[model samples]
Target: MTERELIKKAQAGHNSALNQLLLDNYSILKGYLIKLTLQKELAEDLTQETLLKAVTKIQDYEPRGKFSTWLIVIGKNLYFDYLRKNKNLRNYEEYDSVEKNRVGNQEASAEDHVISGLTFEKMRETLGTLSREKRSVFILKHYYGYSYKEIAEIEQCPIGTIRSRLHNSIEDIRRVMEEEGLDGF
Candidate 1:
């Protein structure tokens, strides 16, 4: 069924349609949260909160934007709210979450595992340096390929603010890479 049809059914209280819509967007939401939080467990927890909010508020959903975008805005708000309430997690020092998911598949060579692990480390390090707002804008725009207008809508900020945040985020990542002499990445 088309997205609109699914949404119509979902909004009308069709459990299957609601499940389908949430399932379809689960990975997108989780993947974005992983990058944003750099903590697998916290991302998973926030994703659950986001989906729950979506389900309870499904009736309030409008078709003005993609459903996935709406889910992200909810996810982002929950994340920020979580941050405000939990000061310690905001430090981004929670390696326990990443370590749990670091195990290689049984078939992968040790060499492949090592290379990928290093890449993940660098990425997490780079992304961890930015403020949450800039990180959200950067991830939505460059990582998720959303237009600035869509990002503004998802973030409920002015387009100019989104542009500025993205610009600063890119610069922040660039500065970190150069300063660390990790330029080749």
Candidate 2:
């Protein structure tokens, strides 16, 4: 069935349809959250909360946009709330795990692995320095390939504001990369 059909059934109070809809968008939402929060565990927790919110609010869902986008909007709000609640609780285990996984999957030489690890480290550090809004804009646009207009809608801001945030984020990342001598990346 089409997504619209599933949504209609879900809105009509069919639990199975709702479960199907949520299942379909689960990975997209979780992956987006993981990238946004840079914490796999937190992302998983937020993903569950986001879906729970979606269940309660499914009646209010409009089919004008993708369901994944709506989930992301909800997830983003929750992540912002989390940041407000825990301002100093940064964790790097997620990044470490990501690097380890990459190394495990790659068949490249040790020197290549070292260079890749350094590049990933520098980029992560640069991202860490970005403001939450700027990082969100950057990740949504570049990492998730969301259009500027889509990002504006998800962020609940004017398109111009999204553009400004994205432009500034790129500049911030570029400046950091240059400073770290990883500009080629």
Candidate 3:
């Protein structure tokens, strides 16, 4: 069935339609969550939570955008809320072994090695300085390559707001890089 048909059936309280929708979109939602949270278990849990939220709120859905986009927005909000609640939690600083091993690979040229190190470190520091909303917008736009319209729909804001947020984020990063003489990156 088409998404519109599925949505119509699901809204009418058809359990099978809802289940089919979730099953069809689960992997896409999970992959998106993984990128946002950078953890497998957290991503999986958030995916489930997103699906549940979507099911419960299915009646509110107006088919304004693709169901996948709607699902991702719900997942993103849940992840942000989780971060806000756990803001005071202790920091865990273990480096990912995969990244470390990749950095140590003999195939890396001198220029490639230096550029990668600097880019990664600068990105980490820059990301830490952005407000939650700005960072989320930037990541969704640039890192995830989502369009402004899609982001606005997901964020429940005007398209201009997403554009402004992305502009400010890029300007901030540029200023930081210039100040630190890291513009070569």
In order of appearance, the predictions have TM-scores of 0.80, 0.78, 0.63
lDDT of 2 by residue, 1-185 (tens): 89999999999999999999999999989988877777899999999999999999999999888888999999998987787687743542221122111112232232233234346657566767877777787778766778878987898877667766666566676666557666264
Score each candidate by Cα lDDT: 0.77, 0.75, 0.70
| Winning model by TM-score | 1
Decoy 3 TM-score against native: 0.63
lDDT of 1 by residue, 20-138 (tens): 99999999999999998889999999999999999999999998988999999899888878886787445443211221112223322432332233355675787788877777877
Name the weakest run of 10 consecutive residues (lDDT summed) in model 3: 94-103
Clashes of 3: 0
Kindly give the stretch of ten consecutive residues in candidate 1 with the minimal lDDT sum.
95-104
Ranking by TM-score: 1, 2, 3
Candidate 3 colliding pairs: none
Q: Write the residue-wise lDDT of candidate 3 on 118-179 in tens digits.
A: 47657757765665556666666655567778887787676666666666556577667667
TM-score of 2: 0.78
Model 1 TM-score on a 0 to 1 scale:
0.80
Pairs of residues at least 3 apart in sequence or in different chains that clash in candidate 1: none
Candidate 2, pairs of clashing residues: none
Sort by lDDT, best first: 1, 2, 3
